[model samples]
Target: MKKKNDHGVFAAVRMAAASHRLLTVGTVLCVAASVAVSLLPPLLLARVIDRLTAGLPLSFLAVLLYFGSLALEGVLTSAQESLLVLFGQRMTHALRSEMSRKLSRLPAGTLAEQNPGEVAARFSGDVDTVEALFTSGIISMAADACRIVSIMGVIAVKNTGLALILLLVLPLFAVFTRYVQKRMLAAQLDNRRAVAAVSGQVPETLHNIRTIRALGLEDYMERRYDRCIGDSYAAMERTNFYDAVYSPVVLLLNAVVVGIVMLLSASGNAQLLTLFGMSVGTSVAVINYISRIFAPIESLGMEIQTIQSAMAGVRRIDAFLDQPERTIPPARREAARGDVEFAHVTFGYGERHVLKDFSMTVKQGEQVTLVGRTGAGKSTVFKLLLGLYQPEAGTVTIGGVKVGDITDRERRTCIGCVEQHFSRVPGTVLEQITLGDPQITGEMAKDAAALAGIDAAIRALPEGYDTVCTEGIFSQGEWQLLSIARAAAADPAVLLLDEITANLDAETRPACWRLCAVPPRAARCSLSPIASMRILAAERSRSGAGNNI
Candidate 1:
């Protein structure tokens, strides 16, 4: 599978944007309307302040107008928030659906690199940042623009010279914002990476905790976790520092701009600058305008940071979705009848050849086993048959059909295999036999369990057929028999058993092999359960008896 490029991230964002189009437009309009309504109160307050020295009738009217504007702003702001929440929900739903569908189509190996825990975090933690783009980003910038425009326009109407003086600081603010933008972008990306690293590490640590304690490496594992968290802290600090430094700086500089505007307005030498002196109302309104401009600049920084992380997360998720999966064609297939053949087949993992011109054939239904010295590709042949790897040269076939022609999904359905390290899953006795195949009913499950010679042990448990055989209680031989039982439940035409007795104690070997002889039919018969077990033990107990004929 290939790692997605920047183009892929853009594509994913575009897809999300498209899916959330109506919501996106609605949120934008709500923010804009909210901003316009919120701007009105401060302008009305300035008017009331400027006109307050007049008598009670005028003052009372001003008070009523100012309070009314406040009420309208409140109503509009609430609507804005409601729309943002609705849109956020819609976007989240679309993003989650795409991610889930991608997981289904992606190959097993690609998903293996990104464990379930990390993938799960994207569904939860990563999508969380998208809210900033719609809510914080839209609302903050819109209100700021509206307030700044309203304040500036009113000031311009009263005195254009004072407005021009305030406008001079805009370029300086832009330069400063651009300076913080680079550090902010890098820090935000780093923070998201750190978050994903922590996400991946936590699950792995728990999964492997047993190994950590077994080798007296608990301290070592703890130190590793500590290091990850420490790195995450540093990344967060770097991210927060940019946000912390920029907002205060923007505020302070805007205050300086206000002071400059104030001095110009108050001094008689600048009488031409404004028709009105620096009245309390004028000072408050000018200060309010400065406050509004600060928001646009400073909020832009926060929005940029949030968007960078969301974009980074989108990149990873897009990479996962876009990556190739095993790369077999849709038309690929092979005949699956257990007539195995290998013809000058050569294969390797990287540069090291594992199979060297391997060639052989077995007739249909023939029980053939490969025995060789260690590292002689004994299991490789079995792996090759099941479509785990493709040949480097020549071909492998079943029923004269080429192995590479078979898709992995199809190949899997046609083969039943028990691996060397077959661990028993945590499940009831019946589940262990059926391997969660609901099609294999209680009767069939018992039949398969009996064939694997696990029925007696299962029946003896605290709950017959329902007993959960898990580690720390059940022995290795019990798990091996359970593993065999799982394979038998499938009713496979050809069963592949590899190293089934690798972990069993010597005393349990004969009984384990004897149990294999009790085929599925034994379970449905009138013979006693132990009777079949006894027959298996007796046959293997005698000399010159082995599993293969």
Candidate 2:
């Protein structure tokens, strides 16, 4: 199937903003009102100064108006910032939710290939950067841009020559801003990659600690980890360098512009006077406007830095969203039966073909054993039956229904698989058995445990079924039995045991074999070489005991 094109982060931002129209509109209004209110204070202060210089008494109303504008600007600015934070939060929530939904649609192979720690960084760190993009980057930059432009418009009226000078210098400042931001963005990207590596390394090291100790590779592992951290530190240093240089250069230009404006205003030449001419009140107001213009300009540098950093995160998130999704088959509501068939099935992982033109059939009520060495397609058969991957050729079916076409919920009830190891979740023993499935009742779980020969072991716990599961609560063999109980909880039609006894000791093997001998209520077919052998041995022992009796 063809993949859907990604619309990128801005599309998500727009959708989030659209959902909260009131917050979006409120933030914009606050920003505009703040910008408009900000201009009033400088004008009022200029008027008050001119009145004092002209030996005129200042009216109480005029003084009140000047202070009132200042207070109003402060209030509007505060409100705008608050609104921005709220808006950013909404965007973050929507973005994370979207990513989570995307995860379910991704191909199983795609998910298997991803590093858990790096994927987590995309969910947490990268998504947080997106929030910062809205609150402190894009929205903040827009407001600062408007403030600069508005202040320039006032200065243009007060002094045309000064406005012209600013216009010429602003573009150069913008070019420099873009240059520095690009460098910072490159550094940030490098830093994020290094951080992800460091995050992944921790889990990898913990998982392989035994092998590392056996091989005496502790020093080597430490050096490798140190190198990742060092890379991150170096990238940060580059970003800091650009950040430190940006503000000082902007301030220097601001001082130079102010100096030139002051000098020209005081010049004796008629042409310079005509262009830069200003009365005492106008001169004070123009200076204030110039200062205001540069303030936002300086702030723009910081905003741009934030934006550049966030852009790196945005690109990564977009890449994740763009990965091809698995093709979902049309939903089928009919219950799947137990007869299994594999016809002309060709499959491979990358370049190595595990099964080519293979065919098999296990009729209802039949138990079949498939014997194969490692890499001889033993586990591959289970994966194909479970529909984790699509076959290169032909079909695998359960009761004439293609396995790949089965929905996740139906597949669970269709086939019960007991893997070599058990996956523990954060919950009580009963929850572990049910795995949070609303369909499975407590009685169903208890029956599954009994079928797996672990019901007595669980009841012996402190709180029986409700006891919170923890490490050491159950031995390794018991954990495997719980896994079997979990699988059988749904009363599946077929049971696929993939080396369920591979990790069990001799003492646990007999119990597992005894449990397998007890036919499940719904299961009509059983497939596994190890399981078949144990079942036959158990049956032979029962027959021998009967004869002795």
Whose TM-score is greatest here?
2
Q: What is the TM-score of each candidate against the true structure?
A: 0.78, 0.91
- Per-residue accuracy of model 1 over 242-312 as CA lDDT, tens digit each: 77888788778877777776776667774554444566776687677667656766766676666666666
- Candidate 2 lDDT, 95-130, residue by residue in tens: 998899888999887888899879888998899999
Please give the TM-score that candidate 2 achieves against the real structure. 0.91
Give me the runs in candidate 1 sitting further than 4 Å from their true place: 1-25, 59-65, 112-124, 130-166, 270-272, 275-282, 326-335, 372-383, 392-394, 400-413, 422-439, 456-474, 505-507, 514-549
Q: What alpha-carbon RMSD in Å does predicted model 2 have with respect to the real structure?
A: 5.2
Whole-model lDDT, candidate 2? Answer: 0.83
